[model samples]
Target chain A: MAETTAPAMAPARPALDETLLAALAAAAGDESGGLTRRLAAQVRYEAAETPSRVRHLWRFTDPARLLPMNLTAVTGAPGDVSHTLAPSVAGAAATIDLWPGLPPVVALSDDLPAGQLTVVSAGETAGSPALAADELFAALNEAAWNTGIGLAVADGARLPGPIHVRVHASAAASLPRLRLVVGRNAEAMLVEQHLDGGPETRVTGHTAITVGDGSRVRHAIVQVWGQGTNGHLSVSTKAGADADVLTVFGVFGGDEAKLEVRTDLAGKGSRSEIVGVTLVTGKQHGDVHTTHRHLAEHTSSRIDFKAVAAEHARSTYTGLIRIEDQAHHCEAYQENRNLLLSDRARADAIPELEIHNQEVSCSHGATIAPVDPEQLFYLASRGLEHGEAVSLVVGGFLENTMAKLPDDVRTMAEAFVGPRLAAIREGSA
Target chain B: MSDALLNPANPANVFACRNLHVFVKDGDQEKEIVRGVDLTVQRGQKHALMGPNGSGKSTLAAALMGHPSYRVEGEIWLNGERVDALEPHERARRGMFLSFQYPVAVPGVTVANFLRASLAARRGTEIPVRAFRQELNEAFATMGIDPSFITRYLNDGFSGGEKKKLEILQMLLLKPAFSLLDETDSGLDIDALKVVSDGINQASGPDNGLLLVTHYQRILNHVQPDVVHVFMSGRLVRTGGMELVTALEERGYDWLTDEAAVAEGSRT
Candidate 1:
């Protein structure tokens, strides 16, 4: 039998911060923000409970409601903040290291939200312009944003090297928010990763990216957290006209995790391809939710996600591809495939397509299957014992999805997958 | 357990089955398909089992290979080792091979890769990449198969003749101690049949025993058998030399059945 590792216990929940709680209650009563306002109110009410030791276990199990709540809470954190709004910032910007262990946040000239793009360096400037926005100022409040690695490219500029961002949870936990924008005709590759190491392992993060017209961006996020850590990743992207975005998202390590990815193809000829794979075992609960919006005509999107569940572990995949009415001639496809290795393991895949445009082409497929006996027999007949045969088949199955990853990330993914399969085999035996 | 009953006449007789009876279960009733049949194949012996449809030829082959669908009341020995308790693939790893009438199509796995895996399992070791390729090429050449077919999905999109040839190729690579060729000549043309028969003859030698099951005497012409057994009503009624195949071809299965009924009537 495999050695049974004990589950790490997180510190009990903290008492409600009555001051923040009251602010949320008042904001909920206001009519302006609509859903955003209502959500703020709900989070306040939930936080009104007496101090308990839950530590967001509820969030781990139920991400549908908890993810947005966690976002509001993270954005509401009290502290120093840096960074600003922009219409377009040009050529050879400086490095703004907001959070060291966090992945780099590189914003192209087009990524600005309809205003002059700015960068305020909390750390030494590598060489770039800094501009701050009113909304960011208010959202950031008095908290000067802890600067993360930042780089800026000029309008119609195309840079070659991949910008690397790394986020780490220090001895004191902190919530960091990143807003990245790319400009029209600008192109760059962004590699963001979260690495946690400290006595205080519980940390949260929120990341939002915007891709502009005639621009292209490739984003890769790999999260490898320490044991007992609770990791929550919420990422949203907006693609512009004739723009292209490709994301290879990975979640390799965490005790309890919830990851949400939402992408909007907001303009014509916009395209996005997202591929992800997670290996979850033991009592770990890994939840992945993706919402893809094809909001304009001739937009194309494709998503493929796979997971392997074993032991008493559970994995849930919820994918939604929505094609709006104006998105005519849009093409969207989503597929979720999973392999279950034990009777105690559970996996749920909900692939949904909400198409409002009659001229659009959309399809979603999901499959949950155990190992094939004939394939197993064929391998076993080649003299592989049953376990070794199962290992080869499982590895081969996951390799199909892993092949979709880029070379650099593919090597790291194999390291994570290899041990997960071994642990699963040992657990079953 | 019982002095390991020795067959001194044929030391190469690697497989033997005694009083083999098999039944098909339907609802609550069981209908026997193989009735008290005894058969033996010495090593290097190319034997043919000729029978009409539904006369239990395939059932016997399946029973010997340990297919789960049939229930048997018998003893089967391979290399003087009891094998009725082993699974089909286990029987295979122990050097028993079956060329199905219709080979299963396994998608996403190439024919050459499948053969290498089977060979590895049979030998309990990994076959080196270079050596495996060389052997695969030799097998394909022996069976007159194009090299491109090795990279395609196993038996998928293959013509009937091509599937038969691939099956022979697998047999040659796996090289089982005892082989069951089940209806290998069912869907072949005259020319294809000769090529297939030649491949089978080249693969079968002094060390391996084969039970070639067929319904027609046409295949027998290309690959003459030392002994031919006739199946009737799920029973091996008569066993004789090559003359039995010729006689049955000149007459028919009904000729033999009618004679059996007459003899039974006279006895009563």
Candidate 2:
């Protein structure tokens, strides 16, 4: 695939002010141009559009209101971060490393098979996204997407183990798009990890997944995108006939994260399971918006999202189950639950369902509640202090959804969440 | 509870509650669950509070631990220090433990991790991981619990026998200054009851006190009680030795409630 530098010619809209763009560019060190360029595209497409109000949390406004994207994240200093597979699980046959301004670094193991990887431009994705790129950051990612990864697993092959994809985002706007294409009757798992150093890191990530007929695929996005980074991600998936797709989002640390995930069941008898676990504390804000669309007969999808927020932290969840007219005999369910860990912590849950066919079975439920008192009492009466008990509860709350993640990915997620919950407990205590 | 470890100069009692009353909100009113109850458990003494269902035995145990759901009044002293004003966790830090009748499930927290955290909090320091694991494994073996319980979530989806065994397992691990066992054997099978009773016996010593809140005397046969208190209508209507448990088992609680009514009738 040829790299296209020429902008896709299209109708003009409101673009970012020249002065503001220049300031954004000047404030960003090595990442200035990319930030300004993406912001420009964002302003052009989304600045004036009216946003849907059904599941809105934070107010969307000018780029000036976003968490800072101009500061630079220190890169690869000693003790910063390492890009490698976990020590316990060692069977990765191939690895892909991504960062800003650097070509993707790929290394193959001795057991790697042929035609497992390729590269393609954004325009070449076979089907349109079921979820529109109308959100400001999502739109910006689309208008500015220059490179993406294409992973193909052959029929009846299981890749031996997961393929590790390490993404390094800077304080500037680092937008990465990934497409995992599992061939017919294949099985595979992808573990995508995000790493950044912060005080003011900004990241916008996008992922596309397509599971071929009768195939099974597990995709995990582990976001340790800096302790105080501002980030956004959108995941779009399509499942073929008789295919099974599982997507897990393990969000650890970020100042503010807006995640949008949508799964499309377009083939008969296809199954999709979307799961997410988010841990936020101490002035951080995380929002998750997900949609499961059943577009074919006998399709089914289950969406489970759980979050823990503490010490002035806030979390918002909005999930939708949409069933079309021809999608009869389908089953779809969405459940969102939040645990408040401090007096100042807040959670908002909104579940929506849109069914065009009465024959379809679609249901949605949401709950925002304090940690269960009985659970706390049981732990505390066992000699755990309040903070320790709360930490245990918070860990448990987040892991209900984490159990769906691949084993290695689950371990990584636990490593990030355990300390985070402990920190939150200490802060509150 | 054993009477073998009492110190004369100091307060030898492991736990004492004087005129304790507990009220919980029901609709628009505070309904009293424990009314004017006085109890004392000396170090090395095993006392059983036996009563029928809804007779406030569990409420007394809960109130003794300072459960937030109930408004507790009067004085509760543990190891000579008054702890009525303490939070449940604070009371726990002071070496008080309540084996819940219905232990809540903490869905994703593994049993081993939960026990380790609790033990650390009780000890005021961290327990080494390897040592903690070894101790937990031993407890599991003693309680006749499968090794898989170490990784399973606390009380989450456990069978009745498993949950009951876990309560005793935790009691053994924490080894509080005073442990209140609330209906710990109600849900256990015959073999499970024996295992739980044996674990409780192992956790017991002269330096600590054990208070068993039970509705059946079947478990008392396994873990013998030195003192027995008959509870009825949210109050201690009668107190005696192990003979009281045998009497209640043979005669039931009707006579206790009848005696209270006659006493009130004559006083009025």
Candidate 3:
């Protein structure tokens, strides 16, 4: 299948002035052979039109709301954030600090495998394809990103411990990028966490991963921004023959957040599992979209996304599964369940499937409902108060998705979710 | 009636309800399901309220437990406290328990976690982890349940017998002062029946009272009832000893219904 690129024919729009581009270029310290790619990305961002509100991808969330407003880039100091590192295996791991309007500070561990893992200013890494520069946000991230980490795992290298990356954005507007490539028969786990931002902060992040034949990868992205921040993040993956990819998303914060994840199965016997848990409370709004495209035979994919909204908060989920004409004997299933905690809280779910092959099996289901009254009654009959019953039911609603997270990350997510549920109960009371 | 029987505060009685009327909304009309039931269960007594289908036995039991779907009128006293105005959980905390006819499934809640939370609420303190686990293991063994069921979701995909067993397990763990088992014998095979009957027998003691609301007399063969009452048309018409169960099993409830109808005709 031909690589689908963002449409080149876009309406003319006012581009960022040359002075801002110069400022970005100077801040990026473009001596690392990334100037040309950044320039091309800028051109694409300038040419691309804002997504139309009628487009299905942008229907639930207004694109204009995500556009970074009257905010200028500010240099971030290392003291502004704190980080911890605990790598499971004796492999090299790097930490890249991304503060807008400043060159990234890259620190590598003592045991660095030369050329296997490198931190670059921009462009592709480890023979991985460059950022698609297609969508408006992708192009913007590629053009303005201040930090990038590229990791390439050699064939047969199995890393039992996960490579954890944590980014805390203190700048008014922040952009961070990552590129990963897993070789044949390799096994790797990556956890990327976006944590801690000011009330007025805005974040835009992009990550691309390429899985070689017979590889297995587990990737989790957890975002816990401030209650008044805005976050937009996109992650895309392409899996080769017999490659298995499991992706988990935990969206717990941000006043208004939009997340998009896409997976392309380009080889036979490849499979993907996408799981997401989003908790919104106290007037927050969250929108998530996912797509799984099958381009090879005997490929399969499943998506399970759950959301809980409380206290006038709202959450939306849109998922799509597409099987190409030649992709035979493929199986795809998608399920979305939303639990509303208050009459004022709301949720929306949209699931779609496009199967071109007659031999494929595809199914999708979506439900948006308040906590089941019968379930509440049953729990109450067991001596649980109404508030306790609500919390238990809400916690159970997200348990399946939370179970997919690693132990430490699951603990962190529970700590974040527990209070939100309690707040909801208190608000209702 | 003796003054002691009318006084709900009598020490000998573990549970009592007076002039209890349960009404449920059916569209725009208020339909009475349990009409003015007055009964008292003494300590150490097992009472069986047998009735035909649609006799409002389940409604009466639910109303007694303070289910919110029904509007209950009258007095419900448990362990010397008037509990008619309390919520279901409040009533439960005051030593009232009801085993539902059709227990709802709570997905993703493991039986162990649910049981722990319930015990915590009942005891007003978190049970020690090791002690709770030991007690749970003992209960599982007594109920003949596989230990793996502790990790399974609470009644999510459980079969009929499993659900009933879980209800009984909860009763034994919580050790309520008064238990209302509404049709707990329905949808059980002979083997499940004996197991459930044994669980019921184990949960009953001299300190507590049991009200077994069932439509069949088969379970009576295992757990003997000191008092048997015939419920028909939203009220109990006859209260007697073991002879009532023996007579109903042979002649069915039609004869009792006819007698109750004649009595109602005379009253009107």
Which candidate has the top score in DockQ? 3
* lDDT tens per residue, model 3, B1-268: 4788668889788999999899999999999999888889988989999999999999999889888799998999998789999999998988899999999888888899999999998889999999999999999998889999999988989999999999999999999999999999999999999999999999999989989999888999999999999888898899998899989989999998889999899988
lDDT of 3 by residue, A1-429 (tens): 122334433333324645565566666554544656667777888777778655567666766566565434455565444332222223426555555565666666555455445443354633443323227888877777754566677777775456666666666677777777888998877778777777777777888898999999988888888767887898888899999999898888888888888999888999999989999888899999898999999999999999998878999887889999999999999999999988999888878788897999999999999988888878877789998899888888888788877675676577678777676546452
User: Order of candidates by TM-score, top first?
Assistant: 3, 2, 1
Lowest lDDT sum, 10 consecutive residues, model 2 chain B, at B1-10
Instruction: List the DockQ of the predictions in order.
Output: 0.22, 0.64, 0.76
lDDT of each: 0.66, 0.75, 0.81
Give the per-residue lDDT digits (tens) of candidate 1, residues B130-162: 999999888888888999998787677899999
- Candidate 2 lDDT at B136 equals 85
What TM-score against the true chain A does chain A of each candidate get?
A: 0.70, 0.82, 0.88
Ranking by lDDT: 3, 2, 1
Please write out the lDDT profile of model 2 over residues A108-174, one tens digit for every residue: 6667666654444332344644664336545655444423355667767767667777777653656
Worst 10 residues of 3 chain A by lDDT: A83-92
Better of 1 and 2 by TM-score: 2
Question: Which candidate model has the greater DockQ, 2 or 3?
Answer: 3
Residue A18's C-alpha lDDT in candidate 1? 36
For B1-268, candidate 2 gives per-residue lDDT tens digits of 3444332214788888888899999999999998888788888889998888888888889888878899988888899888888888888888898888888889989988888788888888999998998988898899889998889998899998899899888888888889999999888889989999999999999999989999898999998888888888888878888888778878988888889888668868
